[model samples]
Target chain A: MQNENLYKELLRRFRLKVTLTRLHVLDVLANTPVALSHADITEQLAEYDIDKVTLYRTLNAFTKCGLAHKVATEDRNWLYALHMPDDAPSEVTSDHAHFVCDECERIYCLPMETGNNTRDIKEEQGFVIRSQEYRLHGTCPECHTQFSQQ
Target chain B: MQNENLYKELLRRFRLKVTLTRLHVLDVLANTPVALSHADITEQLAEYDIDKVTLYRTLNAFTKCGLAHKVATEDRNWLYALHMPDDAPSEVTSDHAHFVCDECERIYCLPMETGNNTRDIKEEQGFVIRSQEYRLHGTCPECHTQFSQQ
Candidate 1:
């Protein structure tokens, strides 16, 4: 999608105001394969006229309103990615499992065939659960095959 | 286990050399109900003479050798907890699902009945996965009941 359309749609979906900073941050996350940390997002926006405090505030805002999702890696760095609407599960978003490639050190969002519907489990366990995030660490397919060949 | 026993066993389990700093850090995590951040650990060890850099280094060493587990909350701070042996499922380790109480902001590690065996999924998906961590966010039973009563 074009930057302008994506910005407008994200603003509408998240009930956030159409500020340039918010839109720019959203754009960076949308294009990233792996979730980016706050420092990472800042590094990417080094050319832009934004400060650390503002970036932190904007990211917090995106998270509070559900425009973005957060994932933590082994380093315990909180990485941010664009979140999909709770009602909609597509190729992206929180519905899928996260796979990190050990060899390449890249992260992939493995799309799920179905939404992580845990109603039955929650009912059985009697948990008033609201959300779930699953993270997997491993070698990617290429690395697997390469290692097997060696 | 007593503090001394825990410290000794932790060093042995993780093949780590025993030091007063390491023992003190492990002692702090053993007493904490949830994973703690570097700052939190520092605060807990205020009576001790450990410096901030040493605290950070000790936490990293503990995590690297599998003596403890690190988790990041929404605030982007790293929290530490002792990791259990793979054969034993415990309340403090990575052998369970993490549930964060939304109202109180307290984190709970619920013991999982079965290990999340992902070999089949990895085979079907053709990815060589190393590990997985599951996280859930919602109200704990106490909070749930209290909120419902209102």
Candidate 2:
């Protein structure tokens, strides 16, 4: 989708106002394949005159509304990624998983399989399930290659 | 193990200096059934005169050496809990998963299932396995009960 239309439509869907910061955040997240941290966005969007607190709130709003997903790393760093309305159906609040490279600290979004059985898993354990997140941390191909070479 | 031995042996194994701050962190984590955030630890250890920055550093060092596991919630809050030397075998760096209550925002550490096959699952997908973290986000029984009542 084009940046302009994608931004406007997403805001409408999420019932959020159409603002430059929101649009810029979507553009930045949409432009990247890997997840981004708040610092990353602040640095990336610095030219747009967006402040850190607003960027934080914008990302939080986006994640809450399913317009984006939050990525958490081993270092306790949080990253965000775009997840369109279609990516997560009502049944699976977060159907996708993250592949985190322990060496590089990058997060990769994996192709998610539908029908999240996590809800069932928790229910079977006698706990009610609300949502789920799965993250795999390790060396990516590049890091694995370098490690093997060493 | 008692607090005295647990703190001393854990510090020795991690090759860290035994200090009040470090010992306080261990005690705080050891005493809690749930993972704690930096604020939680600060509040819990307030009377001990441990400053917030020192408490934060202690938690970071513990997580790095595997003395504790950092739990990241959906809201991007990081929590810490003890990982006894016996709990996480090298095969599964984090053998357990957490159940985070969306309403009350508490993280419950679930008894881990040993020999996590996430590595194998990713290998089947042609991605090299490194480490894995699984988090379940939902309402706790208390919240669930309250919500149903409402």
Candidate 3:
């Protein structure tokens, strides 16, 4: 998708207005296949005239409104990506596993059957429960073979 | 276990000296049957001389040494708790689900069947992955019946 279309579509899907900063942040994630952490995104936008506070706010907003979701990394820093799917609601794609390579630090979203569902669980507290994310860590096929060869 | 026992055992487990603060933090978690966020732990430890940074460091230390594990809460804020026996290291107990009450706002960890191991998924990207934590969100049995009656 083009940068303009992605930004506009994200705005509509999340029911939030798209500022230039938000668009830039979204564009970065949409353009990359791997998940990017807060620091990663900021470093990438170092030349885009984006402020640190604004970047934080934009990423937080993206998470809250479902435009994006938080991805956990081995280093404990929070990572995020463009979560807007084409046909299904975000929940379908949102409840999936994450694959991190053992060689490189890149993170990829892997959708597999994990028998991981929570629709049957009910809220015991008063806080409205919204959504959840799952992550699976392992060596990718290439990395697995690479490590085996060495 | 008594506060003293919990403290001493944790120190032995982590190969660290038992400090007054670490003891107090463990007491709070021991008393707290469910997983707690950093804010929750700090508020509980307000009567002590513990600093927020210290509590974070202590928790991180505890987590790294396997005395505790960080659990995912519905809120983005990370939650921590002692690793229970059901959560043995062999299988993936991290895939267990959590219940956040829409009424009381308390988060409860609920155990479910084991989720699929992701070792079979095709690799994407070269990011190195060292571990995986999976969490599901939903309501508890108590709240489920309560909602049905209402």
**lDDT (Cα, tens digit) per residue for candidate 3, span A1-150:** 266885786687778786788877888888887889888888888888688888889988888877787776656677887777775446523465666665666778655454433343333333234545455566666667788899
Error of 3 at A87 (Å): 3.2
DockQ of 3: 0.35
Give model 3's clash tally: 22
Which candidate gets the maximum lDDT versus the true structure?
A: 2
> After superposing candidate 1, which stretches have Cα over 4 Å from the reference?
A1-3, A19-24, A38-57, A86-96, A111-127, A142-150, B1-3, B86-96, B112-119, B145-150
Q: Which of candidates 1 and 2 is the stronger one according to TM-score?
A: 2
Which has the better lDDT: candidate 1, or candidate 2?
2
**Fnat per model, in the order shown:** 0.65, 0.55, 0.34
Query: What lDDT score is found at residue B103 in candidate 1?
Result: 82
Q: Report the CAPRI category for model 1.
A: acceptable
User: What is the C-alpha DockQ of each candidate?
Assistant: 0.45, 0.45, 0.35
Model 3 misplaced stretches (Cα beyond 4 Å) = A1-3, A6-22, A72-76, A88-94, A101-105, A112-132, A141-150, B1-3, B51-54, B72-76, B84-105, B110-112, B115-119, B122-131, B141-150
Per-residue lDDT of B22-78 in model 2, one digit per residue for the tens?
Answer: 877788788877888998888887788787778778888888887777777655678
Deviation (Å) of A66 in candidate 2: 2.1
